[model samples]
Target: MRNPLDENKLEGHLRSVAAAGCQITLQDLEGYRPQTQPSTTSLEYESQYKLLVQRLVRSFSLEQLTQVLELYHLQPPPKPTKRKCARSIVEQEWNWPSLADVRRKKIDSEFSSQTFPLARHVSFLLLGKDGSQLRQLSLRHNVHVSFSDRPLSLKAEGLSGSLRLLEQDVKDFMAGITQETFALPVKRTISLASIQHISRTSGAFLETVDSQKLRIFYNKSHPHTLVLAKELIMQGLCQVTNLYI
Candidate 1:
């Protein structure tokens, strides 16, 4: 080993040592790793996320959109109504466990106001003018509800337990029986797209699908015949589960 005093001399000595036993591969300037991002793919994903957010935002009412936006630390739009518009606790009406034919203990609608508790699930079971079993569906609102003795008028009461009024009536009562009432049509069939598995949360599968397909009977209706389409769909579900097992 020799002491090289000058910087150039020391560098020359170290280069000679490396030439003797170094196994390093020099890097290519062109082969340098780039720090560029996949801007295109990132933009595509961001676009999809924005679309999903738009859909979710659209589904909510103005009030809900506000709460959600605020929760996520986002700026919400100006609310038209300062009042809290949470879904008014629409009372849940009592439902029938069994159909009329199998009627063992049915809710009596006669003393409905008195017999049934002031505000319990009031199952309004009605019988069609015809002997055929007609089901009565529930129309929400009562007690503090705007009371009216006005009789629901529909000429063609087609199916039993159901009411079918003129299309104009359908548009008129669009807020009550025609407005916002939940009734399941008695369908002897079920579509896979229709029935949903009851969520562990709600414990009830909202039969929104195919429900729209139900024949809407307008006018004064009965509770008995106003059966839900789910009644028939449940039958199909049992059949399906039996086969799989």
Candidate 2:
């Protein structure tokens, strides 16, 4: 007998089940079953199955979506956009109830949490100017990291092993950063050029500010190189000042 539920009704029911955190079953998609008549091709059944899975996957949160992908041992794209990740998950041959059971067990049994106190500058660096680094770290570690601005800390939750590795990565990153700001005189073209040269030669990052100042971030281990860069900027500024006199 043909199931009474259409694709739209089945999708609505699945969305409610997901929101309610209920395990999904093939029975829940009774409406999506192929008709009993001879006109329904096997290819039609396959297409309907894929379409239902795609819609179901979209209802999951990004975190849950990733967990589902991981549960199936599916590799997401390098960029891991939500649409791409969902498409990858939909391609997997999943027994929904079994997959959900394994995902729940894995999360409950192996997960741990940690918080790191971050210096303002360290947080700034880890988050990147655009927050791309933080996103990358979250995906790479398979961990969720939340940052607090007032207290300036990061709270991370993931599998215990991944959490340990993420902690080490954060520490190693913090150890390497050395940030300094330089104030420039009104006529700073010469000083800016000198600073740029120092940045390229020493492999430092520079953040220019309103033509009046700049900030440089480099490894703290290279104190001597930083001293030389500062001297070069000052010397260039002095030369420019003398020329205008």
Clashes of each: 34, 0
Tens digits of lDDT, candidate 1, 131-219? 12121222311111111223322223222222222233334433233212343333234453544322111122233425334332322
Scored against the true structure, residue 218 in model 2 reaches a CA lDDT of: 63
Q: Residue 94 in model 2: shift from native, Å?
A: 38
Model 1 regions lying over 4 Å from their true place: 1-168, 178-222, 225-228
Assess the local accuracy of residue 188 in candidate 1 as a C-alpha lDDT between 0 and 100: 38
lDDT values for all models: 0.29, 0.65
The candidate 1 region of ten consecutive residues with least summed lDDT is 87-96
Predicted candidate 2, C-alpha RMSD: 17.6
Alpha carbon deviation, residue 121, candidate 2 (Å): 1.2
Q: TM-scores, in order shown?
A: 0.18, 0.35
- Cα deviation at 56, candidate 2, in Å, is 57
